[model samples]
Target: MNILVTGGNGQLGSELKHIAFQYPQLNCMFTDVEELDITNQDDIISYVEEHNVGLIINCAAYTAVDKAESDIERARIINATAVKNLIKACELSSAKLIHISTDYVFNGEAFCPLKESDQVIPLGVYGLTKLEGEQYVVSSNEEGIIIRTSWLYSSFGNNFVKTMMRLGVERESLGVIFDQVGTPTYAADLAGAIMSIINSNEKLDKKGKVYHYSNEGVASWYDFALAIFELSGIKCIVNPIEASEYPTPAKRPYYSVLNKKKIKNDFNISIPYWRDSLRSCLYEIEKSN
Candidate 1:
C-alpha cells in the first residue's frame, strides 16, 4: 500500500516515520504543509493522483488549545476546511483515510472512560474545530477511520512529557493539574496501532467509523508529571494543583479518558500501561541525548 502521512514533523507523524521502516511492503510518503498543503483541494488531489496513495494518515492539525480561542479563523480553516479538502481528495482517489482526532470531542464530564458513541460537547475552539474536522470525514461517505486520542507525547515534539522533563530540570518544584484526568499516550504506541490497523484483516464494514485509543491506564496531569520526573530520575518535586490554579484562555476538560474496548476488539491489539510506555519513552529520550 502507498501510504501518505501529513504533519510529518509532529509527534505522531515522527513516530510513524520512525516505524515505517519496519513495513517494507508499505510504500510510505511523509509530507508537511510545505510538501502538501491540505487546505488546497486541487493540490491534495493532484498529489494523491500522482503518488497513487492508497491510505492517508492525516496528522496535521491546529493543536494550540488556548491560542485557538484568539485565532478561531485559522484553527477552523486548518481543522475543518482542510479536512474537507482531504476528504474530497480521498473520494476522488478511492483512498482510505486514517484521521487523528481528539478526546476533547467530549465535554470531559464523564467519570469513567469515554466511548466513541458518547455525546460530543467540545469545551474550546480547538476541540470544537477538531470535532468539526471529524464530521467532515464521517459525512463525506469516504472509506476511513477516525481515531480519537488524548494527551499525546513523544521524544520528537513539544508535548506534555517534554514540557515536564524540561521543567523538572530547570526548577526545584512544579505544579501540575491533578483535577483534569486522562491517559498519557505514547505516540510510538499509537503509531504501532495505526500500522496494525492498516495490516489487519478487518473488513471495511468498520470503515468510516470513530474509535478511541491511548495507553492502558489513566492519570491526572500531576500523576503524569510525577511519573516523568521519577522515571527520568529528576529531583524536582511536582505538586498537585487544581485546574483553577493555572487557567488558560480555553477551558480544559475535567476528564477526557478514552475507552479502548472498541479499538482493541476491532483491531485485535493489546495496549500497554501508561507507566510502562512512559519508561520506554524516557529511555529513548535519554539514549538520544
Candidate 2:
C-alpha cells in the first residue's frame, strides 16, 4: 500500500515517517507544505495521480491557538478549506483519508472524559476551524477516519514538552496552568495507533467515523510540566496556577480529557499512561542532544 502523509515535518508526521519503515508493506511518501501544498487542489490531484496513493494521512493544519483569533482567514484556509481540498482529492483518487483533529472542539464544560459523539462547542477560532475540517471530512461521503486528540507532544517540532525542557534549563522558575485538565499525548503513540488501524484494516469499512485517541490517564499543564522536569532531571521550580492567571487571546477548554474506549476497542491496542510516554520522550530528547 502507498501511504501519503501531509505535514511531514510536524511532530506526529515526523514520528510517522520514522515508524513507516517498520511497516514494510507500506510505501510511505512524506510531504510537507513545500513538497505538496494541501491548499492547492491541483497539487494534491497531481501528486495523488503520480504516486498512485492508496491512503492519505492528513496531518497538515494551522495550529496556533492564540494567533488564530486575529488570523481567522489564514486559519480557515488551512484548517477548513485545505481539508476540503484533501477530501476532494481523496474522493477523486478513491483513496482512504485519516485526518487528525483536536480536543479543542469541545467547550471544556464537561467534567467527565469527552466521547466521540459529544457535542462540539469550540471556544475560539482555532477550535472552530479544526471542527470545520472534521465536518468537511465526514460530509465528503468518502472513506475516512477522523481521530480527535489532545495535548500532543513529541521529540520533534515546537511542543509543550520541548518548551518546558528549554525553560527548565534556561529559567529558574516556570508557571504552568493547573486548572486545564487533559491527557498529554505522545506523537509516537498516536502514530503507532494510526499504523495499527491501517494494519488491521477492519475499521476502514466503518469510514466517515470519528474516534478519540490520547495517552491513557489525565494531567494538567502543571502536572505535565512537573513530569517532564522530573523525567529530564531538570532542577526548576514549576509554579502551578489557574487558567485565568495566564490569559491568552484564545480561551482554552478547562477540561478536555478524551475517552479512549472506542479507539482502543476498535483497534485492540493498549495505550501508555501520560507520564510513561513523557519519560520516553524526554529520554529520546536527551539522547538527541
Candidate 3:
C-alpha cells in the first residue's frame, strides 16, 4: 500500500521517515509544503493519484501558538482550510487519513487527564484552528484516526527538550513554567504507534477513531526542563516559574495531560515512560553531535 506523509520535515514526519524503512511493504512518500501543498485541493488530488496513496499521515500544521495570534489567516489556512482540502482529496482517492492534532483543543481547566470524548474548548487561535481541523477529520464518512498528542519532542527537530539543552549550556539559569502540566511524547513513539495502526491485520477504515497519546507519565514544564538538564548533564539551574511570570500572546492549557488507555488498548501499543523516552532521544542527539 502507498502511504503519503505530509509535513515531511516536521518533527513527527521526520521520525516517521526514520522508521519507514522498517515497514518495507508500505511505499511511503514524505512531502512538505514545497513538495505538495495541501491547501490546494487540485495539488493534493494530483499527488495522491500519481502516488496511488492508500493512506495519508497529515503532520502539516501551524504550531506557533503565540505567533498564530497575529497570523490568524496563515494559521487558519494551514490548520483548517488545508485540512478540508486533504479530506476532499482523501475522499476522491479512497485514502484513509491519519491526522495529527494537539491537546490545546481543550481549555486547561480540567481536573483529570483528557479523554477522546471530553469536551473541547480551545483557548486561542492555534487551538481553535486545530480543533476545526479535527472537526473536518471526524465529520467525514471516510475511515481515519485523529491522534491528539501533547508536549512532542524529538532528536530530529527543534523542540522543548532541544531548546532546554541549548539554553542550559548558553545560560547558567533558566526559568520554566511549572503551572502547566502534561506528558512529553517522543516523536519516535508516536510514529511507531502510527505504523502499528496502519500495518495491523484489521482494517482501520471499518470505523472512525480518535485517540490521545503521550509518554506514560505526567510532568510540568519545569520538570521537563529539569529532566533535560539531568539527561544531558547540562549544568544549568532550571528555576520554576508561573505561567503568568512569562506571559505570551496566546494562553496555554494549564492542564492538558492526555489519557492513553484507549490507544494502548486498541492498538496494543507500548508507551515508554517520559524520562525513558527523553533519555533515548537525548542519547541519539548526543551521539549525533
Candidate 4:
C-alpha cells in the first residue's frame, strides 16, 4: 500500500518518516508544504493520482493557537478549506484519509474525559477552524478517520517537551498553569498507532469515524513541566499558577482529557502512560544532544 503523509516535517510526520523504514510492505511518501501544497485542490489530486496513493495521513495544519486569533483567514484556509480539498481528492481517487484533529474542539466546560460523541463548542478561532476541518471529514461519505489528540509533543520538533527542556536550564523558575489538565501525547507513540491501524485488517465499514488517542494518565501543565525538569535533571523550579495568572490570545480548553475507550477496543492497541512516553521522548532528545 502507498501512503502519503502531509506536513511531513512536523512533529508527528517526522516521527512517521523515521519509522516508515520499519514497514517495508508500505511505500510511504512524506511531503511538507514546500513539496505539496494541501491548500490547493489541483495539487493534491494530481499528486495522489500520480503516486497511486491508497491512503493519506494529513498532518498539515495551522497550529499556532494564539496567532490564529489574529490570522483568521490563513487559519480558515489551512484548517477548513484545505481539509475539504483533501476530502474531495480522496473521493476522486478512492483513497482513504486519516485526518488529524485537536482536543480544542471542546469548550473546556466538561470536568470529565471528553468522548468522541461529546458535544462540541469551540472557544477560539483556532478551535473553531479545527472543528470546521473535522466537520468536513465527518460529513464526507468516503472512507475517512478523524483522530483527535491532545498536548502532543515530540523530540523532532518544537513542542512542550522541547520547550520545557530548554527553558528549564535557561531559567531559574517557571510558572505553568495548574488549572488546565490533559494527557501529553508523544508523537512517536501516536505515529506507531497510526501505522498499526493502517496495517491492521480492521474494517471501518466505509464510513467516517472519529477516535481519541493519547497517552494514558493526566496532568496539568504545571505537573507536566515538573516532570520534564525531573526527568532531565534540570534545576529549574516550576511554580503552579491558575490559568488567570497567564493569559493568551487564544482561550485554551481547561479540561481536554480525551477518552480512548473506542480506539482501544477497536484497534486493540496498548498506549503508554504519559510519564513513560515523556521519559522515552526525553531520552531521544538527550541522545541527539
The model with the greatest lDDT is: 4
How close to the true structure is residue 162 of candidate 4, measured as C-alpha lDDT? 85
Q: Write the per-residue lDDT of candidate 1 for residues 1-289, one digit (tens) a residue.
A: 8999999999999999999999999999999999888888899999999999998999999999999999999999999999998888888999889999998888988888898889999999999999999998888777888999999999898988888888888999999999999999999999999999989957543633999999999899999999998888999998899999998999989999999999998889899999999999999999999
Comparing candidate 1 with candidate 4, which one achieves the higher lDDT?
Answer: 4
How well is each residue in 178-266 modelled by candidate 4, as lDDT tens digits? 99999999999999999999888677533238999999999999999999999889999889999999989999999999999988888
The TM-scores of all predictions, comma-separated, are 0.98, 0.98, 0.98, 0.98
The positional error of residue 123 in candidate 4, measured at the CA in angstroms, is: 1.0
TM-score of 2: 0.98
Error of 3 at 20 (Å): 0.5
Q: Candidate 3: where is the Cα deviation over 4 Å? A: 205-208
Each model's lDDT comes to: 0.91, 0.92, 0.91, 0.92
- Alpha-carbon runs more than 4 Å astray in model 4: 205-208
Q: Show model 1 residue runs off by greater than 4 Å.
A: 204-208
TM-score of 3: 0.98
Encode model 3's per-residue lDDT on 1-289: one tens digit a residue: 9999999999999999999999999899999989898888899999998888899999999989999999999999999999888888889989889999999998989989999999999999999999999999888888788999999999987898888888998998999999999999999999999999887755664444678999999999999999989888999998999999999999999999999998887778889999999999999898889
Q: What lDDT does model 4 reach? A: 0.92
Cα RMSDs, all models: 1.0, 1.0, 1.0, 1.0
Model 2 segments beyond 4 Å from truth?
205-208
